[model samples]
Target: MTSSRQQYIERYAEYAMEQMRRYGIPASITLAQGIIESADGRSPLANSANNHFGVKGTYNGNYVLADDDKPNEKFKKYDNVGQSYEDHSKVLMAQRYQQYVRKLSHDDYKGWAAGIKKGGYASDSNYVSTLVDVIEGAKLQRFDKMVIQQMNAEGKQFGVQSNPLSNNKGTKAKATGMNLPQSSYSMPVQRREFMLITSPYGQREDPINKGKTQIHHGIDIKTNKDNVLATENNGVVVGVDHRTTTGGGKTVTVEYAREDGTKTRVQYMHLSEISVKKGDTVNAGQKLGVSGNTGTRTTGEHLHFGVINVSADNKLQWVNPAAYLAEISQKGNLNIEAQHNGKNILAEYMTAGTKAVNTDEQTPENWMSKLLGSEDAALGIEGGGDKGLLGNLMQMFMTLLMLTIQMENKSKEEKMQAVSDAVINRHIDISSFVPNLKSAVLSINDKGNAVLVVNDGKKEYSHELTNAEKNSISNILQSDSDDTTKRQRIGCIVNAITFSYQASNNYEQIEAQQQSQQQTIQRR
Candidate 1:
């Protein structure tokens, strides 16, 4: 009993070997017994004292310490850590309780699972089940007896070390346990496939944000870009349900077994319709549905692709599919191009390209043929430009040339005939108020001066313009810019009227003063 700890290690060395071969248990169980009983290798009885097992002492009070408990329990202090290991094994093997367990337990995780359950060794109702869970999940059963024997024979040492069971760290080992025999060398990475091309990622605003409450979890797939969806591999449809917010109406979740032997689940959101059911076996390249803007969709059709990864731990992981898709497409907007007039303006690019543009997604060209045709003749003056701005300018120059020819054909008096009945700004319909005004005309001097001619039949009033008026009229006529509005017209007319009225009023006041001065002189 003096070398009790050493004797225990030596005694269980064979039992340890058998358990290791049978259940992939390691040889380090002695280390655990040594550490715990020896109290960090410094217990008095474990050092020079030489009583390692921490056994109890009776009449010999000098070898024992009385631990105060309900009845003051007696604990034997150890002098050597080695003796403690020997005694522990002797106690376990000598006891009748654990004797059957020594031979009955198998190395596979399931046997360990059911065995621990029946043993009543743990307080947890699922104690054995938890071990089995970790064992199966982490592939712990791979440490079977035959595999260990083969590895040992080949001298290919895996994580062959072990520790004693006395350690309270009875939790299941991680997947990185001893690389004994049956373990998977390299686990495959898990993956899943789904179409998420509908909406812009992270652009959930307002209604898609759902009354400022919930967010649009997935994108709305319109009939715009994605006409179909395919499973990346053979898989079962795991889930499908109408979200309070996922689809404008419906959502489908497809799960597949990854090549890495793990599982991946994908979510399809905002579908106009669904074609498959839960538990349906879908293969790669099967059509999920036409992309649609269903629930929570205000605009265009796009698909929202999401990727999910799950571990044997029953936990999930998510990744962004956008970078993946963009990488696959190589920056192409993923739509067909249609050619139009040489200028390649984006017409109906990707169906309803404008209103339905996905957030974060680039825009495609609207190169479709015009569903509504443009105008034909000079649609200004007589009809302006049938061909738009440039055409109108050409038509105006031609009209001016014709008018010059007509003037050359006429005598000087006849040259004035064209102006006696016209208003220069024909669009301003002040006809009923200024009743006698007949027709409008434009009179230009050789000095590049332009005059607006308003002709009444009985009397011809020539309203001449100053340099300021010429500049204002020229500026208004030659304006060519984007984002034009009706307010521009109102402002121009208002400024001209105000300036002219003020100038005329000043001149009339001066004339009135001169008349008053003449009256005062006559009175003097």
Candidate 2:
């Protein structure tokens, strides 16, 4: 699959934030500009040379000539994307733009966006609108909130300590009442207090075969409870089986889909009971079943938590669950608005230099209340009726989901156009389904599986296709193969899904294009 705009945003968000913290440029502006200039790091200029910002200068004496330039203008090249980000920041420090750079607040993205255009950074007249469009479409202004949180933590602005999510206090419940088997291993089980890790993921000496090395796919955590809780979110129970005689006795597998549609399958082995069946949608922290020593190959009672990656080819490869957990820990949960303190920061930066209705009460809380209509609305979620923090989090996530769907639909339209052009020019015969394509919808699930939903005027039919099938369809469309009835149907369905998947945006590239179009309009 092509790199989604969201993927690019995520990839560069940290680097941009780091640069913002160091320099005075707004992180949001930097990110929006990066998306606009680099096509979310997919443009030929960015991919070939790592020149994300189109900064024209020598970086360590390396440069590349522009393909479209009449005089073959040299663009700065960097050894890595990080260097490009660093140079992008340094370029703003140049004398021409130094006045705006010095006067503009780091959080004032709108001012910076307007100022950059006014300072003649780009010759385009619609630079302001292009930048604003990107910033609004992707909600890039959230980075300002992130920076404020960092600043709050570092500066102790409000005497606020660590946020709730960052703190581990009282989160781990004691497994004392469950009467789990006692073991010498006393290391802290991740996200669990009383539970202990008896075995870790990696190559270890095999118990079944003495002196031989074997891969331990997951970490073994001992718990006496009947139901095992999920560690991550968006879990769907995919597989469940009873295997009393095998080493992995009575296993339950749950598949999780990341925001980027990548799938991770987590298996819980040696279960005494299974509560969920296949296809049951489960949430994080939900109980699956009881843990026990039910397998024939087990030495003691423990839950073998294994993580697996489902490849595009439908192959299962085991990965270290501990590593996955650690990576996620650093990212933290963005849904917790209180932790990030988004409301206060967003209000302060968004309306910088504006006078408030009540000058005396112009604090962060007051600003949030003024913007959101009430203190409760700012602290809580509007229209969600006070479901508390978790409820507010869910509401925020729903908004994000809605925005994602809209962006994905636009992306799918673009992808369909590209693929349609390719199919038409190649003389591929999909006439049977081409005229009726409007009634059909295609998408790739987080598991990398293709799903085609077809509406035949009266009834809607949904078919799940494998990666191999999708590839076959792609091959038929691209190759000069003779069209059979089956091949034609397969070609249409697969091509639709292929285009949709390719079109799926994390909203980064589409935002870039929005900015690009603005430049085009200005040039005209």
lDDT winner: 2
Local distance difference test scores for all models = 0.39, 0.55
Candidate 2 runs further than 4 Å off: 1-3, 156-524
For model 2, residues 394-466, the per-residue Cα lDDT tens digits are 2332222222233244454333332222211211123234445445544433332335665545445566766
For candidate 1, the per-residue lDDT at 421 reads 12
Query: Candidate 2 at 192: error in angstroms?
Result: 24
Steric clash pairs (candidate 2): 6-506, 226-289, 226-290, 227-289
lDDT of 2 at 51: 86
TM-scores for all candidates: the values are 0.27, 0.33
Candidate 1 lDDT over 367-388, as tens digits, reads 1111001221111233232342
**What's the CA error at residue 49 for candidate 2, in Å?**
0.8
